[model samples]
Target: MNFAAAVSVALNALRVNALRSFLAMLGVIIGVGSVIVMISISQGAKAAVDAQISALGANSLQLRPGSSFRGGVRGGSGSATPLSDEDVEALRETVPYVIAAAGIIQQRGLTAVVDGVNWSTEVAGTHPDYFIVRDWDIVEGRAFTVPELDGAARVAVIGRTVANELFPAGGAIGASLRISGVPLEVAGILAERGQSSWGQDQDDVIFVPATTMRNRLGGLSTAGVRNPVQSIWLGIDRARNMEAATEEITDLMRVRRNIRIGGTDDFAVVNFAEFLRARNETESQLGLLLAATAVISLVVGGIGIMNIMLVSVTERTREIGLRLAIGAKQADIRNQFLIEAVVLCVAGGLVGMACGAIGALVVESMGQFPVSIEPMIAFVAIGAAAGVGILFGFYPAHRASRLNPIDALRYE
Candidate 1:
């Protein structure tokens, strides 16, 4: 018989056992759906991580004081070395690739009060260049001007979370909020940044001038150094190699800090470029693992198809013998069974695609990790199902084609 005739016969046979055919396709449906959902999750997670990295700024480097050792006891990271405004200036002057730099002093557990509403948050004091280094944008009002930084003005830029809690009625700009009993005018409101890669809420802080924080907010240096800071953030020139720039900054800092040659450096430089690469690599590995698991599920589904096809061959033995006796070729019998398996799998694949798309939508709507479903995802799933049908259906088809007409007739 021709291929079309074989397909028609196979389909007719499946219709005669509709319930059994559907049951046999169940595994394929599940496998395809799993493949789509897993892929969407992996892609979505990757996109989120990339966005967080971007928010951290391009070619950004964060310099913090390293641990200090005293009396054979090691202090926590950033506790030993006290950074200062002078160090920030020296780095900006010495490092040719440093495009922007800022000195920072940070304090946590501060309460902000406006009218009767109060909210607890952290605050940071930094130079205006911090906005450039951190890639932070001012959505309302403006950042600190040069005069504001130099005069230690009591002006503030609040993040989205603080804005929402304190100024639910809007008009946060030009409004007054008191922190640590110090009243400050809100000069700007920061654009929303959802979360950092480390799971910290990025949009839950307040920003003020570096001088204001040191003189007014109570983050003074223990070493009595003038204009001391907790950390220094630098934005490197995009065209320069980040590692080279980092090395130059480290050398400059060591010299400026009076650390002798061969002595352990008392500072740490965090290269954001390297951080992004590491995060991407980790995400890629996770995606590969998820893909492998989905593939295993598809294989298991194929095995199910194989078992059902074997049962089908046995149950239709008398029918097969009658066809063979009526001058049906062995090749025709094999093609008929193969077509049936493919049709069943293809049908299941179409349904699975719809289910997977719905599942993706549901996940996104639930505010879980983002999900991305591409057109290629559907194509891959459908192709995988067809391939599974062929791989598993071959053995049963071959067995049916090899049966002797007389023996098959007598067995039934």
Candidate 2:
């Protein structure tokens, strides 16, 4: 028989045992579907992590004071010692790579009252240049003026979450909001920045001038340190400048704070570049592990296909004998069986592709994690499924081809 006729015959044979054929292909369907879903979701996670890491800006650094060793009971960075405005100035003067720096003071449990609607949130006090250090954009109105930041103006910039909660009806810009009984003008509304990598909400706070927070809200005091602010933020001129800037800033903080050499640092300077690299590496490793799991499933699916094809050969002994008796060559029988196996796998692959797409969509709608479909992934899955069929189906096809015509005919 010709190639087309052999394919037609093989298809008819599958059609005759429709239930068995469907059962045989089930493994391939599951294997391909799982692989596609796993790959797409892993890739999406990697992309999301990278994007979020970049949100912090590659050249940014956060400086926080170290422990104070008060009464032999030491607490961590935030309350140990307070960073001052002088530190910010010294960083600018001493470090050439440090372009801009700002002092930040945080006050939590501040109640913001707007038209009798009160919401409790944390407040941040920083210079006007803090926005530049953070690479933040003011979506409405404008950023604080130098006069506002320097002279303790009662103007505040609110984050997206704060605005949405305080002014559900919209129009947050230029609104008057009272914070802890102190009325402050809303100078700007920040754009939405959903969440941090550590799952903290980024848009749930307010930004006021450092002077305003100190004077109006009362300066934050620490156990051992006389005056304290939460942390200092700095922006380097370039990504490559982080290492040198960190060293210089550390040295300056050491000398300024009177920290002795061979002793622990009195302050912490955190460079975000190292964090970015570590995050990317983590994502890549996670993707590789998931990909390995997917490959293992495919291998198991291939084994299932082999088992079913072998059973098929045993059940079709008389049919093979009859074909051989009709002057059909061994190669023709082999080709016919191989075609049948390939068709089954290809059909399973198609169905699996559809299942994978549906799974991805369902997962995405749940909003728990990121999932993005890459079309090329589906094609690769289908090709692998086809390869599975060819590899697993060969042995069964060979056995059928080598069968003795006389013995096959006499079998039950």
Q: Using TM-score as the measure, which candidate wins?
A: 1
- Whole-model Cα lDDT of every candidate shown, in order: 0.88, 0.84
Task: For residues 1-412, write the lDDT of model 1, one tens digit per residue.
Answer: 8878888999999999999889888888888887888888788877877787789887799999999867778888877768889999999998999999999888888899999798989999999999999888999999988799999999999999999999999999999999888899999999999887778898999999988887887767577688889889999887367888889999998888788889888789987657777877887688779878878888888888889899999999998999999998999889888888888888888887788788888989998768888899978888999999999988999899989999998875
Error of 2 at 177 (Å): 2.1
Residue 117 alpha-carbon offset, candidate 1, angstroms = 3.5
Best-matching candidate per lDDT: 1
lDDT of 2 by residue, 201-285 (tens): 8899999988888889775765564334678888999877788888888888888888777867767888665776787788778
Error of 1 at 184 (Å): 3.1
All candidates: CA RMSD (Å): 3.3, 3.5
